[model samples]
Target chain A: MHAVRNIRLCTKDCLCLYVCPTGATDTETGQIDASKCLSGCRACVDACPSHAISLIPAEFPPQQEKTVSVKNALLTLAASKMDQEEIASKLAETTGNPVLRQLAEALGKSNRLMAEDMLRESGYMLPQSRTVGELLESLLSEKQPADFPEAAVKRLLELVNGNTMQEGKASAFEKIDY
Target chain B: MMRKFVCGICGFVYDESLGYPEGGIAPGLKWEDLPEDWICPLCGATKVEFKEQETVIPEEKKQSSLDEEHQEKIRELSFKELSALCSNLSKGCEKQYRNEEADLFRQLAEYYDSKSSAAFEAQISDLAALIEADLSSGYENANRRAAAVSDRGALRALTWGEKVTRILSSLLSRYEKQGETLLANTNVYVCEICGFVYIGDEAPEICPVCKVPNLKIAQIQRG
Candidate 1:
C-alpha cells in the first residue's frame, strides 16, 4: 500500500513531508510516489491533518462477473444510447438554430459517454484478463458451425507461439469448412 | 391516462406512473396537465422539446422471450468465429470515425484469440498465428482510416476510451496479483446503469462514479 494525497483536501500543512521516511509524500505534484514509498507503510496517511492522504493497495481484488441476462440488458441500453448519440450528432450538423445545435452537441457527447460507460460495464472494455482468457478457451473447445473460421484460429496460434515469420505458406486448414 | 414524455436533449423519460415527486409533480398527472413552463429535470429542456415515447410497462418486459432466443443465437458462435466477428466489427468502426470503439473492438478480438492460445498452449495453436496477422493488418487499416476524418466529437470519445482502457488494465493487473481468494471475502456490487463495481457489505446510497441511486446496485455471488 502507498499513501496518495487528494490535492483538493490537502491543507499544505507539510506534516506528510516530516512523517514520510522516503520523502514520497514531499513530491512537487502533491501526489504520492508509489515506487519510493515503502509497502504497507501508512505513516504519512496517519499524520495528515486534513485526512487528504489515504493508503491504496498496490493490488486490487478481482471484479465480479455479471450474469448473461444482466450483460444482455446493459448491451441493449448501450445500443440505444449509441442511436441517440448518432441522432444528436446529425441534429448538431443540420440544425439552423445555433442554440438548438449547441444543445444537440451536448446531448451527442453525453450519449456517447453513457454508451461507453455501459460498454465498460459489459466487460468489453477490459483487456485480455485471465478470467476472459479462460472463458474464451472454453468457448473454443466447444462445437462450432460448419463455416467456423479455422484458418483464423491457426494463424492466431502461430502468432502466439512467435512463429509469425513462417505464416506465408497457405495451409489445408483454409479449405476445410468444419 | 398516464402518458410518457422523453426529453430530446438527454433522453430522460417522464412517466406519469412515477411523477417527479421531487419537483412537486404528483403521480397520475397527465402530460398536458404539466405546467407549460415545466422543464426536463435532467437537461432543463422545456416541455416543447419533449417527445412522446413508447413506454414499456413492467408486464411487457416479461414478454421478451424472443429477445432471449436472439441472445442464445449469438452465444452459439464458436470462439474463433466470435474473434473474427470482433475483428470485422473493429474495421467497421474504424471506417465510421469511431476510433475509440474501434480500439476496444480490436482489444476484444485480441482477447478472444489470446484465450484460445492460452487454452491450448502445449499444442501448435493455429488461431494464434491468424490473430497475429490480423492484429498487424487491423492497426494499419485503423491508422489510415483515422487520418481521413477529423471530427472533434470522435476525438473526444477516443480520449475518453483510452482513459477508461488504462484504468481497467491497471485494475486487471492488480487483480491478477491479488488472486480470487482475497476477492471472495469481499462483497461485490455492480451498478445497473454504468456497470461500476463497489466492494462493501452495503451499497452506497449514491454511486460515487455515476451519481445514480443505490437502488440500481446488485450484489454478485462469490464462488
Candidate 2:
C-alpha cells in the first residue's frame, strides 16, 4: 500500500512533508510520489489534518458475489426509479410553474439516488469491475445524443480498462452483444 | 431576445447578451458575430461543440416549494416506505463512516420497521432478464426522453448515471462469469463523488462521471 493525497481536501498543513521518510509527499504539487512511497508506511496518512491522505493497496480483492434474487431485486428497483424519473422529467418540462419544476427536479434526483443505491447493492457501481467495461462498450455502440459526453465516457473506459490487464487480456472482456 | 448556446462538452452556456467579456467578446455581440475559432472558456470546447439552448434561469421563475400536491405526496409515504428510506439514509451515513448518526437513523428505521407488520416482500428473480429489460432498455428510454426535453442538468445526470450504472452492471457480469480469478492481483479504488470504481493499483487523476480530481477518489481497503 502507498499513501495518496486528495488535492481538493488537502488543507496544505504540510505535515505529510515532515512525516514522510522517503520525501514522497510533495506540497507543491499536492501529490505523493508512489515510487518513493514505502509500502505499509502510513506516516502521511496519520499526520494529515484534513484527512486528505489515504493508503491504497497494491492489489485488490475480487468483487463480492451477489445472489440472483438480490440482483433481480436491484434491477427491478432501478427500473421503477427510471419510471419515476420519466414522470418527474415530464412534470419538469410541462410545468409553467417554477416551484413545480424545482419539486419535480428534486423528486427525480431523490429517485435517481435511491435507484443508484439499489444498483450499487446489485453490483453495478464499481469502476474496477469488468461489468463496468461491458456497460461502457454497450453505450458506445448505441447512437448517442448530440450533447452526450462521449469523450468523457470513452476516457473513463480507458482509465477503467487501461491500467490493468495487457491489451490481449483486456480485449477478451469486450463481448459486444449489440 | 438574446439567444443562449451551451457547450456540448461541459454544459457551459454562452449567452448572446453577455458575450464572454472575460474572453474579449463584448456584450450585445450575437453568437454568429463571434469568431469561428472562439472556444468555451470553461472547457476549451471548440465553436462547433456549442448548440442553441432555451433560457432556464430558475430565479426568473416563481418562488416557493410549498405545492399542495407535493405536500399530499409527502403525506402519502407509508410506514414501510419510511422504514426503507430511513434504512437507506442509515446506509448512506454508514458509508461515510459516521457511526453515531448511522446508529440514530438505523434506530429510526427499526422503529418504523417494527410498526410495519409484514417484512418487505422479495419481488424479483432472474437477474439477467431484469438487467436486459429494466436496466438496459430503461436507461435508453430515459436518456432519449431527457435528451428530447433538452434540460442540460437533467440530461447530464441521466447520462452520467446511466454510464456509471452500466459500468457496474458490466463488472457484475464479469464477476459472475470469471469469479475470483478476475480479481487475483488488482486493487480497487472508488470515486467518493460519483462512485466510479477503478481496478488498478492507483486511482485515476480525474473522475469520469463527475470530473472530480484524484483527491476525491479513495482506495477500498477490504479487511
Query: Who wins the lDDT comparison?
Result: 2
What fraction of native interface contacts does model 1 preserve?
0.01
lDDT by residue (A28-125, candidate 2, tens digit) is 65577888999878988888899998876543333344444334434555556544544555566666655444434544444445455555554443
- Lowest lDDT 10-residue stretch of candidate 1 chain B: B118-127
Candidate 2 lDDT at A51 equals: 99
Question: What digit string (tens of lDDT, one per residue) describes model 1 on residues A1-178?
Answer: 5666777789899998998899887677667778898887788878988998876543233333444544444344444444444555566666665543443454444444555554444443322223333444554586856655444444333222221112233542343222
User: What is the DockQ for all candidates, taken in turn?
Assistant: 0.02, 0.02
Tell me the whole-model lDDT of each prediction, alpha carbons only. Answer: 0.50, 0.55
Worst 10 residues of 2 chain A by lDDT: A169-178
Which one wins on TM-score? Answer: 1
> How does each model score on TM-score?
0.41, 0.38
Residue-by-residue lDDT tens digits, candidate 1, B99-179: 565565577666655544322111112222322332334222322222233323333333333322222222233334454
Task: Indicate the DockQ of the complex predicted as candidate 2.
Answer: 0.02
Count the clashes in each prediction: 20, 11
- Give the per-residue Cα lDDT of candidate 1 at A3: 65
